[model samples]
Target: MGRKNAGIKTVCENRKARHDYFIHETYEAGIALQGTEVKSLRAGRANLKDSYASIQNGEIFVENLHISPYDQGNIFNHDPLRRRKLLMHKAEIVKLFAKTREKGFTLVPLKIYFKQGRAKMEIALASGKHNYDKRQDLHEKAAKREIERALKDRQRY
Candidate 1:
């Protein structure tokens, strides 16, 4: 299941992350955004799909994340898909790097939102899901939905 992001202004989300991977843990990290990039994100022009975090030289960076160029920025607009740095603690980065080194573990961005007027991203430590596992998840969700509908109908009588 996806993380619950209540009481926050969500800019964009990777809706398929939960379906494609089994999330183990999540972290809230500040994004290092350029002036135009921040404006673009505030205007709701961002995509988290296919974005992933990688630790390089003991620092974390998010790759493939697209924040569209601000409409009025023109010549000063930042690159839409530049590698953005993520602000996280030293010890946490080391821990995450070690975990990602393990087989089948990776970092996936779940969502991006503004918290107390600052841009924050929710990144997850996840493992990929096999075809059979995906099928099972679908079936379980269907069953839960049917049960809820049946109970609602019963109460209406």
Candidate 2:
């Protein structure tokens, strides 16, 4: 099947990232992973909830990401929480760095998925959301649910 339609064996997800941050932009970047790490990720044992990205020297790297070791791998197995490098074009990296340097902007990984047999990360440039904003979002969601229910009931009559 196509990459978009491929069966999702999700490696990790950052659920709270969207609730706590207002995402401004998103970019897809390839991840540098060892063979064992890739195997472990394919088994859906990765964690992205506590992960974040950082720039050092001139390269970008993902930190705090946990990729559980393959239970069957030998001494060559990879570390679960090792800092992995993200591969993006020079221009893209520069743009990301500039935007994330702003007061509240941060580099957050939203999800990890495999495409064309390669691992990829969906990263977002986001700003922290205030308590009031979160409350307002919840209220809007409730309102939308009410409207949808009313429409469905009317259609059934």
Candidate 3:
């Protein structure tokens, strides 16, 4: 049997978020999008790279999320790089705000997807990874790949 999220469809992912940060927690957030923005997202014209979330005045907003303008929107097309609000509970916002105030802790969007026709974003509470830490992770990944290859070869022979 295969595990499938029947109604969820991924739109975009920030692949570098994992390599650059140590993720501590993840939150599913609803994006407050305009009509053109939602249409653009449905067309798969969104980018999560270089985007991060910030808490301001008791509200959470995402910056640098680029959702291209809808082709047919013409006069009413929304700005591609405008900050978008994230919908989450007030208690959760307070928690995230506190955590982000700590040294090196930040909110990074991991991926954006649609669930049952509504756009959603998966954001993470993360801390930055140092150069050495990144190098160590790469080395470990290489080692695991080599070990897997050796095991497969052994079984084949």
Candidate 4:
């Protein structure tokens, strides 16, 4: 049998968001896409590196998410960097709205993937990581890597 999530296709991921922000809460929301955008995504031509989510007029939207136009589309092609709406429950939206209004909290798009044949976005409630925090994390990771390597070498010996 195949994996449970075998049908999912990851179009893009914002790796920098994880490095720059401390994620607090995460949500999976459906994305609104046009015909050409969907076609482009099926071809794996999307970029979410600099994308983020925002609340406006009691609704949530994703900004700066680039979806390349379909090759066969000309006039029917949608804008590559359009702001798309995210579909979420009212309670979730309200919570996200409240959390983002606080100091240093933000809504970032971590990844975009097709789930169950529908496009979905992974949104994270996060706070910006300071320079010192990032440095400490790097140091910790390096130390862990060194220890793991040492253990492997000792086992081999």
Candidate 5:
């Protein structure tokens, strides 16, 4: 059966996260945002390039997340790079805590989107990739592209 709430509107995505880390699992968590922050997110004025999530004192918080201030908010605008709390179940938090404690594992924000009028973040359990791994991935991608180009040229002839 199809999902009941499938109309997710993506606000921002961290494409570099996939390239820099090996993502193991993903979880959806709600964000605690202020009024102006919500308005700015709705306008798609957000960046997740260098954002990351961390568990602190039994609660999860996202840091370095940039939700630009609302243009019309005047002095009531929220800080662009303020830390925000993330809402997840207690059981889920415990599980994440255990996993993140392992060596080289971390919580990374993959994307931020609106689901059924509420903003949610897609966070992943990831481990950083080595420099050689990144080079290998780029080489493979280039080889795949060259193969596709050759096939297309042969078909044209």
Candidate 6:
């Protein structure tokens, strides 16, 4: 039988990133991973929390991304918090760098997943959300939940 759910398998997601930033654009970039790192990722041991992308010396790199070491790896385990290079087109890098230079705009990794056996990261160009903006989003979400609850109750009756 064919493998079930053979599409993209998500390894980890940064939920906090969504709550903290207003994402304007997203880009898919390949990660330069070591052998142990790839093994650990395939085992679903990775975290995107507090991880962010930045332009450094004309290249893009992700920092603070924690990829747990492979349990079976003896002496070649990669560092959990090493800065990893992200592979993207030169033009895309230039655009992203320009946007990040603007006040309050930053680059954050939204998620990490595997596609066609290759690891990929979804990075977004985003702006920080103000406290009031966060509160407003929460209020709107609660309102939508309430409306949905009311509709379900009406159908039940």
Provide the TM-score for each candidate, comma-separated.
0.95, 0.92, 0.96, 0.95, 0.93, 0.95
Q: Which is superior by lDDT, 4 or 6?
A: 6
Pairs in clash, predicted candidate 1: none
Encode model 5's per-residue lDDT on 91-141: one tens digit a residue.
999999999999999999999999989999999999999999999999999
Q: Rank the candidates by lDDT, best first.
A: 3, 5, 1, 6, 4, 2
The clash numbers for all candidates, in the given order, read 0, 0, 0, 0, 0, 0
Alpha-carbon lDDT, every model: 0.95, 0.90, 0.96, 0.93, 0.95, 0.95
Report the lDDT tens digits of candidate 4 across residue range 86-146: 9999999999999899999999999989998999999999999999999998999999999
Candidate 3 per-residue C-alpha lDDT over 12-79 given as tens digits, one digit per residue, 9 for 90 to 100? 99999999999999999999999889889999999998999999999999999999999999999999
Q: Can you give the lDDT of residue 20 in candidate 2?
A: 93
Off by over 4 Å in 5: 1-5
- Candidate 4, position 11, lDDT: 83
For model 1, the superposed segments whose C-alpha errors exceed 4 Å read: 1-7
Top-lDDT candidate index: 3
List of clashing residue pairs for candidate 6: none
- For the record, the alpha-carbon RMSD of candidate 6 to the native fold, in angstroms, is 2.4
Candidate 1 vs 2: which has more lDDT: 1
> lDDT tens string, model 1, 40-100?
8889999998999999999999999999999999899998999999999999999999999
* Stretches > 4 Å off in candidate 2: 1-9
